[model samples]
Target: MRPQLRLLCDSSFRGPQRSRDVASILREVDELQAKEIVLVAQDLASYGKDRPDELGAGSIVDLVRQVSAKVPRTRLLYLYPSDLSDALIEAILDSGVPYFDLSLQHVSKPHLRRMRRWGDGERFLRRIADIRARAAQATFRSNFIVGYPGETEDDHDQLLSFVGEASLDWCGFFEYSPEEGTYALGLPDQVPVGLMHERIAELREMQDAITAAKRDELIDQTLEVLVDEPGIARSHHEAPQIDGIIRVPLTLPTGSFASVQIVDAQGPDLVAQGADSAS
Candidate 1:
């Protein structure tokens, strides 16, 4: 079986020169006959925000269209940073792959301001609802920082509430680590290390339950999964490595698409068996 290709597009890729090179990149990938392509970007929504003309397109939506035209047969997945917008969400849904990797550092309004990011829990929840409304099978993954400078109890509570309400398919919580020459390092009221650990533990516990329940919901349902290896497969709901995997029989060949019926849920992973079709 051919190996899957992962294309990493960093912030520099958003520039005009690099943006224009996307076509050639797609052409190369096509020439290689890659069966699957995972497009990793810092912020896909900001693809052409800096200079649309250089991209030869107005937005990421146009880029998605271009990819589909160029590699219609290959499966495309996106791993992007959290800079979501209505248009970007629409574009992702249009791509027929509804997996979302939102890098929301934190969601409290004040803490988000400190983190130099935008959007609060309320705004994010609304967007999640909108996506779910449009695509019932959509899956979401996000990461959050637990203890930033000046993180208050209220802020923590807000994050807990958001975790409960969002019901994301996957979540990661990390204790803040001050980096050299960063604004956060100079901020006052740094959270104690012990407190940071405690906060992260609480957040992880809540999200774990949510993730388990989400996985449980898939039991008895059939899905089209791409077998990564002898015993590991993934449906559209699971990303390549960061999310849970669908366990399948060893008889399934690697890198082949198969229909499987989910027979059991094991926390983040699901067990499946060969099936004729989705039901």
Candidate 2:
């Protein structure tokens, strides 16, 4: 069984079929005894013609509690999955879920318009910053697409700056992959593979620096790091895996806690010393 699993609400559209569907999913998750789950109500936002039932107040609270209590380590991740506002986000986090995942393609509004993903980089980053300010320990992640057709060098630069500001824990940089039946597929002058790879590399480098700085900001701070065995030292920005894991570097007799010092920085893992004779 995967340590992290997503319990996604198949539909977030406002319809009789979706309203109570999420609650039912929870029941099944409990049956399976799933402890850690990332619950997402995908496409919660308005998708063209239909405005699905917005993840309402009471409903979101109920769902957050259901998953949190049932699974101690459970976290709820909000996706472009719906039309939720800052109020709804605050309510949801207040309700229990502290992890927020926003889908952001590019910082360039023009690029976003081309792709048809609503919202600009500024607005989205503000929301994420707000969320982190509200909940410091909250996990923030986002995905961006590079090399979209008609993307200029300026567009890529803007994205790099935006990533620096966002300080996202997890940032995914994707080269534009055209899928059949989508508007992007019909677009002309698609980006070349070599250029796309270059852009991806640039964006990744910027993100790497931002992540390192953010992780360094957490130096010497106590965190209830989740343990992943067979781990090694990396950097403050990195954990065990690419996605990251909380590393406690002492050989524990059993599962236990140790005080660690942030000694170095790697991609996303932390190099720390733990469990000395002295505290």
Question: What TM-score would candidate 1 get against the native?
Answer: 0.87
List, residue by residue over 1-279, the lDDT tens digit for candidate 2.
223555354452334224445656677677766434555555433222231454543455456556666764455554572355665576456533466666666778888888777777778877777777878777677788888888988888888888877778778888888777767787877889999999899888887787777667666765544343433322222322346544455563223333456554455655555633221
TM-score of each: 0.87, 0.75
Which candidate wins on TM-score? 1
Model 1: per-residue lDDT, tens digit, 1-279? 443555534454324423335666667767766445556555555555556566523466666665656542233343333556566677676654678878777789998988888878888888888889989998898888888999999999999989998999999888888888777899999999999989899989999999999999999999888787778888878877778888888888887888899998887889896522221
Q: What is the C-alpha lDDT of each candidate?
A: 0.74, 0.60
- Model 2: how far is 60 from its true place, Å? 4.4
Give the poorly placed runs of model 1, Cα more than 4 Å off: 1-8, 12-20, 56-58, 70-83, 274-279
